[model samples]
Target: MFGAHLDGVSAGPGINDNGSGSATLLENALVLAQRNPTMTKRVRFAWWTDEEQGLNGSDFYVRSLSATQKSYIKGYYNFDMVASTNGGYFINRITSTTAAPLKAYWDSLNLQPEENVEGQGRSDDYSFQQAGIPTSGYAMGAGARKTTAQATKWGGTANSSYDPCYHRACDTTSNINATGLNRSADGVAYAIWNLAVAATPVPDDFSMAVSPASGSVQQGQSTTTTVSTAITNGSAQSVALSATGAPSGVTVTFTPASVQSGQSSTATLSVGSTATPGTYQITIVGTGVVTRTTTYTLTVTGTGGCNGGQLIVNGGFENGTSPWTGTTGAIGSPAGQTPHSGTRFAWLSGNGSSSTETLNQTVTIPAGCTSVTLRYWLHIDTAETTQVTQYDKFTVKVNNTVLTTLSNLNAAAGYVERSLNLGSYAGQQITLTFTGTEDYSLQTSFVLDDVTIQAG
Candidate 1:
């Protein structure tokens, strides 16, 4: 490809025309050979001795190959005139799909390149493409004037030949641009790495686990829980999640409805106050290439109607003081006041003096009862308007030991209902007491209504 002294012409150096391609190709082959690369496909390099004389060596080599031997080639790429002086980046406008990697290298540099105008069918790759093999190549321009558009895209003097001494005697070491040679060498190396490497596809698969999978909810409250997802036997993927078979008035929501593989997310299950009382089984499913399901149990309690259903005697006080014993203060059923439920409710009043009033009830614990629940609606109003400390107070007790305290300072807005788990005293007879005490100056009233006790 260099100085072979062609017929009827003086012997001269051809370093800028085909010499740059031959040298770059040889360097690439030598580097790969030095590394002893373990490649998926075999890479073969050819140096055509007479490309200057109309591609005689490459044409003879292709004609000698059998059809089976030719079919082994997936693609053919040529590099010619790659380091011309004042080189303008150029890529072959290939008619086949093998041009993607060649185009990608220029695109990654954000460089706008022109097509291979000077070295189209005039190189050794033309023989491969004529045999229906996919072809792609790279070339720095040769003997062509750089237009104004090329100057704007590649930043060079316009209307001047890319290589002023192409195919001349002086096209020697001085004819090469060091920066262009380095960039063109890097591009050729990238093409070899992109095309000769084997790729393995990843399979999509995952699993899910909901921690504390079983839980309880009050008839009208919400709960938040966590679920974790893990990718199994695959690369990262997005998994869509959903819930099925939830009870009435119970809504389930996932914070991130979709999650990346091998990562965990949270799902909040909100049970409305009017939700039906029962045990519900909900299945949470995550869908991707494969579907996975996890089951969660939700138990709802305290739907009222406990007198004939085996627990409370007068929960709503509709029977009017039949089962409760009042002691030590003015405590009675008040009429025409706001009640949480039913017409009458019990009220304990401390009219402007420090006094304590209490209501007691003795309930026999049913045998084999593993858990007990106490729920009631409460209201407190007081004239004690102080921030640092509380004066008028109300409390609940079991056997005269304080269980929980309530006051005007901490009471819910407008008689909200609350629940208590008395599972520790499941098999013992217990005295449940509701007490209210007022300080010396301000009068505060404590009201209780719509109470229920259940054993399960």
Candidate 2:
């Protein structure tokens, strides 16, 4: 799906804020209709209204979808302010599969696009994201000032707001950057063509292969390869893609997750810092009417030494609670409490009533390590006035064995570092857990962040 807001603010003409995006979408739709190419997947174009009123239009559309209906949508692409006089090329959710085609289109033009941090959670795409649908888009930038690096790359004045007339009366057709608009429009078409239409007509059957079938990566690094498909015998059909046989400390993800036969997708292999160094075969399976398989050889080179081996995955809670499981709202970046380091942390037992919240992840301590240590930063805050009462309690445990315990009595103003020597548990798989238990009166919050299990 491709979408843009049709409504604008009450300020000026609001041409540059969204006129550029809407015009681009219309032009692409016209061209696509004229060409009338054979499409493997359905393409949707949405021009939403009331976007200025807190994304009400897009939010309502998403809220109206059933689970099965939502699942049918492969991805969503949004275009908001794609043409600013001093704007720089930016891609929303740049790391996602939905952004792959847009990024590739920009990269082909040597545009050196950046992630659109300034517009995140401030646009219509946020609506689709909340519905768990993959979304990505383009932007020329908005109220943010262009930095010197951006100016040098995209050729604009440094420290100037990308859109000086944003949401203002002066925003009109004259404010649109023709060059930026042209590039953004072309990128939108490029993504749509790559995602929906096939390059060449073929039969119903499809053939699959991976480009650069073998690659090498170092620990703590990542690499990507393209998975291509071509129609062989039958008509185009959806091919669901998945990867398996990855070793521990390694993760495999596909951008589109699934694609119509004859469309290609990007497969990314991320190697954790502590991944065992070796060669491995990763199988990419595409299941459509029939299952087709391809293999990619991955060689993992070690970074060397124990200091480079951190066993914990997403210990800092930066990756949104993957590999760790517990309560629904246990891990997040809530407004009241700040994390020890990153924007997210494990927050437990702030409910103020009788409650228990637990967060845990399982990892193996490598056999040959001479020393192993666990470290985390903790911040405790409480509404309890009494200093001596241990009303709310927090505990750290390894393999269900208590390592240490603290209470509201230990509450302090800021974060404190806690460390434990785990040499005794070396060469064993263990579950590290943090549990918070609150009593019936005052609320005590136990926040943990920047966790790591290092072995030497």
Question: Which candidate ranks first by TM-score, i.e. highest?
Answer: 2
lDDT tens readout by residue for model 1, 1-456: 111112112222222232222344334444554453445677776666687788888778778989998888887777777667767888776434676766665666665666787777888778877877777777777888888988887777789888777777878766776555555555555566657743443356677888879777766667766777886654667888899999778998998888886777777888787766556788988887878888877766543421111355777777758678876233344453577777777787647797877888888655444457788888877777776577888898989889888776864447878788776775678888899888888877788887776665
**What are the per-model C-alpha RMSD values against the true structure?**
21.2, 23.1
> lDDT for every model?
0.69, 0.82
lDDT of 2: 0.82
What are the per-residue Cα lDDT tens digits for candidate 2 across 1-456? 556442222112222233223344334444654553567888887877787789998999999999998999889888888878889999998988889989987887778899999999988999999999999998888889999999999888899999888888888777877777777767776678778876564445688999989877778999999999988765788999999899899998999999999999999999998877656789999999878889998867666423225689998888877989877477888889998887898888988999999988899876655557789999999999996878899998999999999999889999999999887876788999899999998899998999988775
Name the lDDT value of residue 40 in candidate 1.
65
Candidate 1's C-alpha runs over 4 A off are 1-37, 199-456
Report clash pairs, candidate 1. 220-273
Worst 10 residues of 1 by lDDT: 1-10
Q: After superposition, how far is residue 282 of candidate 1 from its true place, in Å?
A: 55
TM-scores, all models, native as reference = 0.37, 0.40
Q: What TM-score does structure 2 among the candidates reach? A: 0.40
